[model samples]
Target: MKTTGNTILVTGGGSGIGLALAQRWHDAGNKVIVTGRNAEKLQAAIAGRPNMSAVSLDVTDADAIAAFAKDIVARFPNLNVLVNNAGIMNAEDVSAKRDLTQAEATVVTNILGPVRLIDALVDHLAVQADSAIVNVTSGLAFVPFPKAPTYSATKAAMHSYSVALRIQLEGKVEVIELAPPAVRTDLTPGQSTREGYMPLDDFADEVMTLFAVEPTPEEILVQNVMPLRTAEANGTVPQVLERLKAL
Candidate 1:
């Protein structure tokens, strides 16, 4: 949207992509509130920040989401932007006799959490002018990463959901999907310092530019994420799959 003067809530905003977005928006004069399960982490993220705050929220907990939504709505009555940025990624070997514990958890945090939060806030948003909902999916949503199968699947689900949500909320709220590539974030252990990942600041810089677009685009796709985002349409799925296999 306009990128400024809106009250925004971002889940999993303690670090990584969420942190970057929260800070950038806050800098642009928006009152930004970030949430995380870890209270300490949330505090640390906004330690020296003005116009930015944090709240403890375990997105996987339906009850917690409900309470947090009520509290947040009362606290920030002008809230108009909800960024569904909280997500988890883990490597799962489908070939093995797996318990699927992590996979189930991934579904809860990555998919259910955002859906629940949206359900809680949709009514509030519909009444606000120029409201927006930003769902953070991934480049992997377009091409599955063999190792993180469930994570990719969850993101794909969000991608599909965002499309429908946009049409359904056509006049009431703006629906946007931000499909991030392999950014330098610790979405998985060691991913922060890993090779072949985009630098966090660099990615954030590019993303902020996209967010400033007038008549905001439905999908914010950065340059690095374009290949996979367009892979299916260009008939490069096989080639992309092979490349992913190597990674």
Candidate 2:
């Protein structure tokens, strides 16, 4: 993926990792458009960056996603990059809970949302010269986090989907999975300032550096995530899984 001169659309760009990435791309002379569910948050994100624009979108709404894709294609004809960053994370108890509504919501937002958006935009993307699809998954995908069981499962599903999508679109469009470790974002709330989470700016910087390089279609893993990726490759994933279960 080229770092500059591309019209990029980032979902959930109002805050956290999404906004940080949008800001970085905007600064690098790219036409960046960010989308979110909240109008106020979107406005706030675009206020400081003149090169960035904001669109109101709720990825969970399938009908709204369809409309958004049509409008975006008509409005920004040069759009070649789609960043599937919009997602939700929640903790739920499966044992005591009567309803799995929270888990269902997580599956919808974290898994189906990106799938629907990609389905809606693939045709437009295929026609573009150097199009790319960047899917934002989590380090939890490699090893589940018991506390956020459903959230972790959804990300794992996304990781699987991204691999298949990349293979299918091999020659037509570039598909990249950005599996971030615990980052300093509202997604983890109190844990953002904790010991292990990577700073938002630092994460964004590393991603930009990776993007500057040509089509390397590999998962962009950061700092702490390297150990997990390495362990999985070395067949020590079972041990890592046991450690996470203990957590």
Candidate 3:
């Protein structure tokens, strides 16, 4: 994918990794539109920025996604990049009976949200030059994080989905899966300042650098994430599991 000059739409871009990547793309000369459920947060994210805008969107709403797709295409006809970055993570106890609300919400927002959005915009993207779809999974997808089991499962599903989507869109649209490590972001309470997690700014900087590579990699795996990403293949799952347990 080209590093600049494309109109990009990033979901869940009001804060954290989404906002970071959107800002970097904007700085790189892309017209970036970020969407989030919080209108105020969205506005704040784009404040004092030109060629960067915001729209309110609830990815869990199928009807809203359909409408947003049509409207966005009409507004930015050259929009060719879609970043599926919005996700939620919740710690759940599997040892006892518990409310499934968080689990269900995770499934909808983390898995179905990207699937539906891709369905809505794939046709439009296919017709555009230099089109790309970036699916943000997680390092936990490769190695399940027991504390956020549902969140891990959803990302794992997305990883598989991205593989299939890439094959299906082979010639027309590029499908990239960006699997992040445990970055210090507020995806969960107190995670933003978590001791062991990678700093948000550091992760985002590495990500932007990776994006600048010619013939960009299909999977954007930062150094900090490599352990989790390769644990299974390297036969180090047990060691990785022990490390996660310590966390």
RMSD in order of candidates: 0.8, 1.6, 0.7
Please identify which of the two predictions, 2 or 3, would achieve the higher TM-score against the true structure. 3
- Candidate 1 wrong stretches, greater than 4 Å: none
| Global CA lDDT computed for model 1 | 0.94
lDDT, each prediction: 0.94, 0.88, 0.95
The CA lDDT at 164 in model 1 is 99
- The lDDT-based order of candidates, best leading, equals 3, 1, 2
Candidate 3 has its poorest 10 consecutive residues by lDDT at 238-247
For candidate 1, write residues 149-232 as lDDT tens digits.
999999999999999999999999999999999999988888898888999999999999998888777899999999999999
lDDT, candidate 3, 157-207, per-residue tens: 999999999999999999999999999988999999999899999999999
Off by over 4 Å in 2: 242-247
> Which scores better on lDDT, 1 or 2?
1
TM-score of 3: 0.99
Flag clash pairs in model 3: none
